[model samples]
Target: MATPQPRRWIPYPPLISVCASLWWLSAAAASVHEFPTDGTVIELDDASFERAISAFDLILVDFYAPWCGHCKRLAPELDKAAQVLAQLNDPITIAKINADKYTKHAAKYEIDGYPTMKLFMHGVPMEYTGPRNAELLVRFLKKFVAPDISFLESDSAVQNFIDMAGANFPVFIGFGLNESVILELAHEYKKKAWFSVAKDFSEEIMVAYDFDKVPALVSLHPKYNEQSVFYGPFEGEFLEDFIRQNQLPLTVPINSETLKLVKDDERKIVLTIVEDELDENSLKLVRILRSAATANRDLIFGYVGVKQWGEFVDAFDISKRSKLPKLLVWDGKEEYHIVVGSEYLDDNDQGSQISRFLEEYREGKTIKREMDGPSLIGFINSLISIRTVYLIVFIVAVLMVIQNFSQTEENPQFRGIQDGAEGTDASTSHIESCRDYQPVNKED
Candidate 1:
């Protein structure tokens, strides 16, 4: 009929159809997901999990257990984060599932530990290894909702981008540079860092980021109050290497989340084990570690708190009896080195101790030791410390010995036999003979 009606031709039927299809798609997209406006962590179960994941463009789901202390600590932070994130134009949903209760769902996602976070973007899942503090977590999650490479037309836009980027993740801004230059990197490292191009920015902005050249790419670690500028050669591995190295701050705190970052890095870790990472002494030591890290950019300087993660500390053979603020160079695997002379750091001379340790490490003057046990499993399942495990074994052995002795005493024949064996001088004679016999050295 349309062909026959060609004489009364309908102009641009395809264009009309395409316009109608686009309108339908836009409506469908709007209807497919209705983001929550409540700004509270949505409690999810097996039944609603899939629906929720498909309903939001970006969602951070915490796979948690009811009795998990870490999960409990994370709840309030998540709550605060939900409130802040919900207000964004493209809201990010914060949700949790009791992995313990919903074993099927947990197994599907490979959630082996408590409070494991996974971010779902358009139905694809990736592990969420960002900061846990409420404000920092908000900043970290914002990266997902942001454009891969933001184009800033004005200086005000640059300032707004930086202010909005926050301090959780490093931000890269290309000044007087083209988007095509950093496009690939922006997409590659988008999850770990923020990347943008400042189309219009003044020298004052350059001074703020500590760069003096045009067509410069500046990397900012606002959390650590650090910034570095790279001039040109932004085509290949050189640009990537610079960006990769700067993903983490000069010194990173070793935790479950940050540990993921450290593991991905090729550099060895200059690990400092402290009594409490939040304590004043530990903070001061972290600053020293940062200085060392600055000097030796090839190595990652990290610190973990014994109080915060005792099992991890135990893996390094550190205990309450051991010296405080222990320094070791970890290969980020099973083996680590303790400098022979500078094994333990003195609180008074921590800076010197760290310098000496690093010096000895470079000079190959250190003792290499395997971690006490498999640290990942130990971190998750070791509710009690290694010392506690030993103590329990000791107590059980002592109790078994006492019970065996009581049983032997109750058995008259066994007691008489034991007494006879104890009274025998034959055992004593054998011991004396063995002591008198010297071990003969054999010729190779």
Candidate 2:
């Protein structure tokens, strides 16, 4: 009984060491998976979301869900965009967050759908509604990353750019002056056109266009061999007006070109039906329309020389006996005289007549006939044209209509598919739960 038992120590099991090693390896793999290995796109999460977004001048974020089919399809487009954008002079950062895993980030940006792409510029976020193609993405990203204005001081720089540009885009060159304001236009129309500033003009450049001043704008369409010259006080609103006016044709003729212009334009077309193509009065009408056009870019100014095209005059119902230069407007659906009666056509106050016409149109005083507005079929076609937004609206509207029809008098208070959604109290618990993560403004 007194025999002391030899002290025994249980040998440590091998499984303990093996289990610890597996746990360590798992953690290492998780850390690696948390970040994107490729440099094209950055992986963001709740912790680094704000800082990462704020670091870039312009960053496009893809709020995606793993199980979403649309999200999976958009992944390749986003990766392609990221790679292409990576090569820009000033690159735009393309990043993504797994909204399904990071529900907080999804809630922050109000992500109700998968693959929601937003362009955040200097902390201000704008939803991207453009096409989801590589070409459109490149063009769209260039809007945020492009230089405001490129200066071409030497003839070689100007010539090289113009010649090498392949005449695919319109080239706007400001000669003999370097105004900072042009940069504003450059930013606005960067995606639509190319802009450059030249402090001095070469003899060849000046000889091509008839401009004598320093602040002259030359709109060159190399493909069409067309050039529009504008000389002006190029510093303020006037400069902006000049740029806007030159961006489109001053007066579009009514024919094949007119059909394309009208079909493409969603705005009301202010058309002057002239009996003569080169008539002085017809030209005056065009000039007046141009003056009006300079202010209201929403309205397109065009002239139909109906003398040769009598069928068009009948189609628009323009009276030949009324006046040589009769003014009427087409809503891209039906044509109506600018003035209800023909008296205003020859009025000495031509500007006032046009102004009155526009004012009446804007104030809803101008009556829109069944023909003046889109027909039922045309309206349906137009609805389809705005597919993404209007399609959703149309579906919702149809559902509401069906739901209303399905409801009976017995349950008059029935609230269809939306049921308690509308006018229901939204819980503030989410806000309360997220309060800790919210950034507090120091001033508050």
Candidate 3:
């Protein structure tokens, strides 16, 4: 929804350096001592053509005619863009190639548009294209120039976002970074969920959205505008409330109201058997479940644990009338849907039991799968954080050092044989008569 404004009239001297390739080496050397001061502009011509393009990793080619109104409007924008990109230390050489003078090269490129900001990687055209505004131009050029992919890919990344988060209808494209997968998954059940959400990272959109320290998720709801989100990490009731509203096809959390439904109502209930200590693997599984449940409705969740009981009760407010680690598909009159903790559905659903649960919830069939590998995979992935894996490596290095030191202390190879060999100490015992005779002759 952003539009390019008319660029202010800026002069071209700052943008038109005579021998830019020669100046760049000096500039790069100085930039290390100081900061990136200013951007160098090279005017490209047919004379030293091939050599100029090779000077930089990325090149922002501006093919413009001085007479055109749009070209004039875009000039100042390009200047501002050069300054911003300089701050990022992007190695894109900004060349204002005179398309008018170099008609052959322009025609070779199939010049269909005016003021086209095409990002060429080694002379071949690629995406990272946009209109003439400096901000947008900087964003377009960043992917090729900057090493880290911190900038947003505009609305183009939406499809991938859906795939990444396992989202469906009414996707939220981070209106203000509301991406926490669990809360968004939870909120989709409330009402007729519609509308998607997304973030507006004035510039650095992708970094802000990566599965980084900032909580992130791409969610979809059944209804177009009824989608929901949790921008930051959530815990206890905030998460439960969001999930409950979404009408997730998974188990409804066990609590006082849920207990009443099992006792006095006609509907069924399904509860996940949470262990005493809810580890990250279990937590990730819950989030993934929340995502898959978007396609289903009717099933409820339950939790049973004496150790983290307070957390469970506070999260969902359940009573401890019947405490069994079971996934009870409670049909109205009596407990009907019972998948015992000891028994598990087999191999076919190694990683997709949550999906199976949703399918069963909607289609009135039971689906259970043993989630061992995926569970362990998730556990490994969780533990493979920056610090934890490094800690393991550190411990291994220390143990190896200790083992080497222990071997060295047990064997001091002074002549190769440590204990039973003929050493210098053993030879000293045989030199008795020769030494005594020499001392006696001298005295005599």
Candidate 4:
């Protein structure tokens, strides 16, 4: 049998381009996220709005008044819908006529209620009426909106969705009606589920399913896009069960909170993101934390490996890592005093940087850090080794040294003087007498 030959080297000119391309690839591989919400909103008269409605998949019109109670309730719902639409990239054209402000627009739609939704297809009204919940409206609008269900697209592609999915399909969308705790658990495995975080909500989707409460999860189906949705606010175990029930593969998103939790409160935060479950990346971050914690006992050190939503993974909407392990001089919403690698972490002169971060934390600054490098995981096991104990011993030793030095420095002749110099009895000094002396004052 012929021995296998080594592969030929890459050509020169091509290699140069390849190097450049590699550089570009490395830059791109840094994981820049794209948000799901994308689109423009407008508040205009019907005449001006009708022109652009044709291009949009769904043109949702809201008829309302500034003073109506029903309208006020509908306001939050519609705003939520707009936000969801924005996230979906479906781009809803919301024309709010304060029946009193745009009587012409309101009158043209023949609006009876203070709040109403008209779903238009091709610039012509196909389905109309509101007083509906957000999910229902979202569900109802799906028929008209293309479900964009081409799985060939990266799972990262979530700008907009129109599918029977939710409960019926392969995906899950969580709503605000769900509890924060549930969301927190969902967050734990957030990469596993697609969540829609909302502060307010509408019953459109709920009434459609006759279920209430949020942080709801709606499963989706590609064909039944219009009516597909499972209700939820699935928390830790329950959410986990649902995933298992569906036989969904577990997606390990970077558990920002959990990773931060694993750290000793005194450690700094370290963040990392990689293409796979490679230990090289994991060890890189762990080592950095190990070193920093070793150097300074005051740091609240931690390391996060971003698989998804665990803090370092690129978020589709915000397109950034939210939390990482690094000493926090301050508490930022998504930031901290960062240390990128051993180069930055192992600096002998971290005095200014460390102090600044502490001061920042005092002022309640928060930080989300993303860091990389080899030296990161090197010394994690020796973190903050007996630092408190050592500090106490060092202080006591310095005090003792000072006391002994003062005793030895004293001269026999000057001993009395030294005692009298700082002594409580001033009379012992030669300069002063124990008896008081009277002094004459002209005023007396």
**Can you list the residue pairs that collide in candidate 2?**
none
Regions of model 2 farther than 4 Å from truth: 1-39, 43-48, 63-74, 97-116, 127-132, 159-171, 180-194, 207-214, 220-227, 247-298, 301-366, 369-444
What is the lDDT, from 0 to 100, of the residue 422 in candidate 4? Answer: 72
Q: What TM-score do all the candidates reach, one by one? A: 0.71, 0.48, 0.29, 0.26
Q: Is candidate 2 or candidate 3 better by lDDT?
A: 2
Q: Name the runs in model 4 displaced over 4 angstroms.
A: 1-41, 52-55, 129-131, 147-444
The lowest-lDDT stretch of 10 consecutive residues in candidate 4 is 245-254
Model 3 — TM-score against the truth?
0.29
True-structure lDDT of candidate 1? 0.85
Q: Give the per-residue lDDT of model 3 (tens digit) for 1-444.
A: 899899899767655574575588687665342322367555667654444555455667777666657778988887788776766755565667777677776676755445555566776664333446677566545534422112234455554544432322223344444434434443433222222344443334444344333344434442222344455445666654544444332433444334443344333444555544267645554555455444334444444444554443222222365442333354433224433332232324423665555445555455343322332442353223333466788999999999988988877784367444766666665465456654446557
**What TM-score should be assigned to candidate 1?**
0.71
Per-residue lDDT tens digits of candidate 4, residues 290-355?
A: 444444433334333344332233321112343232332312123334322321233344445444
Q: Candidate 4 — what's its lDDT?
A: 0.45
The Cα error of candidate 1 at residue 305, in Å, is 4.6
lDDT (C-alpha, whole model) for all candidates? 0.85, 0.68, 0.49, 0.45
Steric clashes per prediction:
0, 0, 38, 78
Select the stronger candidate by lDDT from 3 and 4: 3
Question: Cα deviation of 17 in candidate 1 (Å)?
Answer: 8.9
